[model samples]
Target: MRNLFCPKCSERIFFEQGRCARCSQRLAFDPLLLVTRRLEEVKPCSNRDLIGCNWSADEKSRYCCSCALTRTIPNLGSTKNRLLWSRVEEAKRRLVYDLCRLKLPLKSEANQLSFDILSDDPEEGPIMTGHSAGLITLNLAEADDLERETRRVAFREPYRTLLGHFRHEVGHFCWDLLVAETQLRGPFRLIFGNESQSYENALKAYHERTDRSYDRAAFISEYASSHPWEDWAETFAHFLHIVSVLDSVAGLPLSLESRALETLRDPYLESDFSALLASWTPLAYSLNELNRSLGLGDAYPFQLSSVAIGKLHFIHMAIQNGCGISACGWRAAPVPVG
Candidate 1:
């Protein structure tokens, strides 16, 4: 989420901008360089004419890296589905941007990370959003603000959004990528618990329990307590959340003399986990207060306890180590059913 500017006119731009507003230069995001470049001939992505993707394409593949990962999309015959699909792609591209910035290994086409954006059309039955192995499926309905809000209220979740869903499910995929077979597995088990435990039974017990006491000190969310794997995924998701947000607000003049902010670097490349947290704590607190003053809900509703911090450290270490492995060498685990 680094600030981008149009090279033509120097006007501020965004990750998804297709044209520079001031100079009318065509724009495309260069995933490799992690910057928006002005395109002279507008060598737009194949999806550009179809779904409005503004990214540059790979000369060999003719699809942008992010769009290439989409295995399936909802029915485009309906105008509603087309709009929802575009929104989903926008969020997915942002997720890919963060992943690339971290220099993590991405699966190739032989065993690529794929997405299936499905709709909740009655004929298609209910579409449950979840990740399996390297493939992540999302419900297109979640793109609708009202529908997403309704589900958030029903689930009693403090916060939920399309980007959060992408980050969380990708966490599951990364666990399989970076932790499942590595030497880190032992340490991961020690911190998150035995992932070998029955996920189905744990989820059943979680839903049946009457006492919904969430010890924020121990768990990031009540849903995270469903199983050891879930705990790992939730912690992984939060690690991304914290670092990404921190990166966005790192050097802002918040009118406070803070050492952490003064020496802030890119959180993705930050080796010291504690220093990142030090900066995040005060920033999150101030954001929550700002939200309250505006009569809005808390911007950051969760608290990171010592125990939770330990789990995040494990994720940070895993990612730091895993990024060195060759993308093709990593094996994909079988997708768990049920």
Candidate 2:
């Protein structure tokens, strides 16, 4: 995601901040523009006189941009719900911000979209990660690292994280875009398989068989090995994961020079995977080495497959088309990974 700063003071602001410490300015985030503007200084909200949200206090009206997208927030009476819901909002805002920056479409799940949210029986549930009727539901519990890690270990996945959840679910959303478009549907079918197949049975098959030969050439994760749509989601998530993480690493102190090299030529948009990977090689190496110094595992846990690269190519194309960025042309031919 692109970096965010407070417009008034240029203070680095967190996505969730309602006020800026550096400038003492109330702020509101514009979800459409993925930007935070000073409320007191610019576009002061008319509502500020009545409701007194910080944005209103600053004089900008119409719900600081991010809050406008909220169809419903859990009742704020419960402190626990308020805190957990805030975490959800922060992550969701970042996700939506990137979507906006990429000029991607996001309709409310209520607006006839394929996405939906379901409440597990309040008494008994995994407490996170639910899928129904094309809408993936997230339990607020996942925002807490301890709970997420516990579930991750219990699920026995090599990796699991909040951003992973977002990217994966978005893959399902984008599939709707491709399948509905006449130009892309046939190619999707040829690669990802008949998505109309029984999802439940496919999942059961994945869970029951331990010895099934894994198809690395076509998948980014083991769960992806279970189904074509999953393959797409896993790969899509990784594309976001890598790009965002690489940008974050670039912002760190250790590798400013390498960061310059990778982004200097627009590796994120370039169709040439070899050139992109060359830029990434040194960064990934330094990342792993840095992790080792701290007694941690590799910073990135997965390898890119030829199949995954093909999916990434399609994703990159979709993003470019979505954003109207024509700096680099896309390739229709699938890229093969050795």
**Using lDDT as the measure, which candidate wins?**
1
lDDT of each: 0.78, 0.59
Model 2 C-alpha lDDT per residue in residues 85-202, reported as the tens digit of each score: 6555555555555566556666433332232222335567544464433455666666567877897887677877665676677667766654544577778779878777888899
Which residue runs of candidate 2 sit more than 4 Å off their true CA positions?
41-77, 108-134, 211-213, 246-338
How many residue pairs collide in each prediction? 0, 10
Question: How many Å off is the CA of 75 in candidate 1?
Answer: 0.4
lDDT of 2 at 194: 74
- Return the TM-score for candidate 2, rounded to 2 decimals: 0.61
Poorest 10 consecutive residues by lDDT, candidate 2: 110-119
Q: List the residue pairs that clash in candidate 2.
A: 39-58, 40-58, 43-60, 44-59, 44-60, 45-59, 45-60, 45-61, 115-135, 116-135
TM-score of 1: 0.72
